[model samples]
Target: MVKLLFLLVAISFVLLFSLTDFSGESPKHGESMMSVHLPDFRLIPTTGASGPESFVFDISGDGPYTGLSDGRIVKWLANDSRWIDFAVTTSTREGCEGPHEHQRTEHVCGRPLGLAFDKSTGDLYIADAYMGLLKVGPEGGLATRELDEPLRFTNSLDIDPRTGVVYFTDSSSVYQRRNYIGAMMSGDKTGRLMKYDPNTKQVTTLLSNLAFANGVVLSQNGDYILVVETATCRILRYWLNDTSSTTTPESRGNYEFFAERLPGFPDNIKRSPRGGYWVGLNTKHSKLTKFAMSNAWLGRAALGLPVDWMKVHSYWVKYKGNGMAVRLSEGSGVISEVFEGKNGNKWMSISEVEEKDATLWVGSVNTPFAGMYKI
Candidate 1:
């Protein structure tokens, strides 16, 4: 009996060691401040709306059109100071009434994410997490689904100003937005960067097998595209002038590494009028979480655990309610400035940043209000 007990103890020790290989190193906290200052902010409340992940203006520059949790694309009317319903991505409205319904019925209600405007046509393009890429006319109502065949998680997008061609990212081919946490822990590399031509309706794969491809933005001259791989914490650039076309899934375009070892997982990137780009850091990276993710078996086991318990173990959850944004110089990829939220006024999970009229408009996926800060 003693020998049997000793064997069991040894087995337990080995299993525990395998499951709990946490790196003692901690993730670097963002630098407190440098050249950027936290501007004065006011929250624009979206009545019964949640998760305004992105924002775009019409050709007239009259709106900050955004998609809410209830699958409705709404426009903030400056005259009225309220959000008016503009378009619906999904026709089925059953059980899609409240702000939190998306947590349960996203597949049914549609969770629209990225929003971009075709400046020439005055049409709005949407990246719905569940319904795929969609377009709505300037006079919005029901959005027309453009591409749904090869997408699982349609995350963010940008449209070329001159050609009107749309570029977007599929966060994961294996996991939907609802299971995003699972996709992150699983080390999903099936994400992709794709382009859609409105004229031909042809969808072309620009790059594939990305590590959770998240944001996409076209260069100022439209010569190249920048895509963020959130899982690897890196940015990749794909040259549009490359005439060579390869059909491989791993390598699809003339791609080059742009930025890596980011302090946080970048969510969305937008062009800044100051000859640079604004990147929103969803949350600061955690070394413990990175260590946990290195082991697939441990990640799978953690998924089986209770969600409340899992939240405690998540790095994002540990650093919730903190905000960080970085400004990178154009082409050079130099860190120009950093913007952080003030104490007691944290802007949690900022997914999009838009600069207009000397003010920065910030949108969050987990907050009820959109923030506006004058620079």
Candidate 2:
């Protein structure tokens, strides 16, 4: 008991003090930058399933549609006051039914991670972990597989409205969602940031050898896109076109940090209605994570131990009924913030959070329901 308490207290200090940035750059948003009140999330239950990892709205702004652990994509119907089935994944989900299917049948049932909708075509594109890229029409049904080659762990995505091209991430070839803890700590670098061109029906890889690529979001005007590297706690920017006078095609917009040294490890990123972007911080960015990311041997040693790395990592961070998220400007400055977990509803570990019509819609990979907090 004494050892457990010591571990908790030591990690708390690490979480508190790690945000001090020494480099004279733009102001980074850490735990210290938060100044808003914690939001009390109103639960939106998924009936009997969990892990709605991504939230996306249609062009008409009718949905915050999400995919579930049970190989189903569902949308919230506000007028009917319930969630309705929108689409099913490409994997054959013959035995995929019940809560927390991720523990056993995620691969068999086709676990969908990221979702986006094309404004021009009204088509919903999905990045299913087991079945690669898939899409459904405006009238939802069984999703059609988009890619010929399989992706091991397709994570998140966003659509460019003007061009109708899709940007997505392949998390890792070595690790699937069933053992994400291994991917996070094993120093695996098999991830990629890719795009699918609808006109050509071709998928192209823009960036390769990414470390745990998790979320992908195009900039507000589609100048460039940002992809979150979860293991490194930083977001990378890759330009699609040479807008700047100094940049050339050969440069490839290499090694640009959109945001770095984040307070928490990011999951999904989305555009804010007001300005800037909203990032879903899945867990605290502790010193162990920072050191482990830099030193491969330390990461492997920690994972090699007999201890359950998932539980140790979980206990190393705090929920404590204090959920939080951040809004960042294009310059990486904190514009607005929200943090709360009231009434036994713990949303501290978020998969994605987006603001539309003054409400914060939240998704988590570990929860049975999505959450809503009105401003």
**Tens digits of per-residue lDDT for model 2 on 106-184?**
7888888899888998999999988888999999999998878778899888888898899999999999877788898
Of candidate 1, the 10-residue stretch with the lowest lDDT total is 19-28
Give per-residue CA lDDT, model 1, range 1-375, as digits (tens): 755655554454345534543222133355224223344577888788687888888989888888888888999898989889999997898889774546678788999999999999888899999899999998998888996576899999999989889999999988998788788777779999999998988999888998899989998988888899988877887888876323445444587776776767788998898878888877655544455546665555555544533343234433444556777778766566676665555565667788888877888787777888877
- The candidate that wins on lDDT is 1
RMSD of 2: 5.7
Per TM-score, the best of the predicted structures is 1
The clash count of every prediction, one per candidate, is 0, 1
Off by over 4 Å in 2: 1-40, 243-255, 305-323, 333-346
TM-score of each: 0.84, 0.83
Worst lDDT 10-window in candidate 2 = 20-29
- What's model 1's lDDT at 242? 78
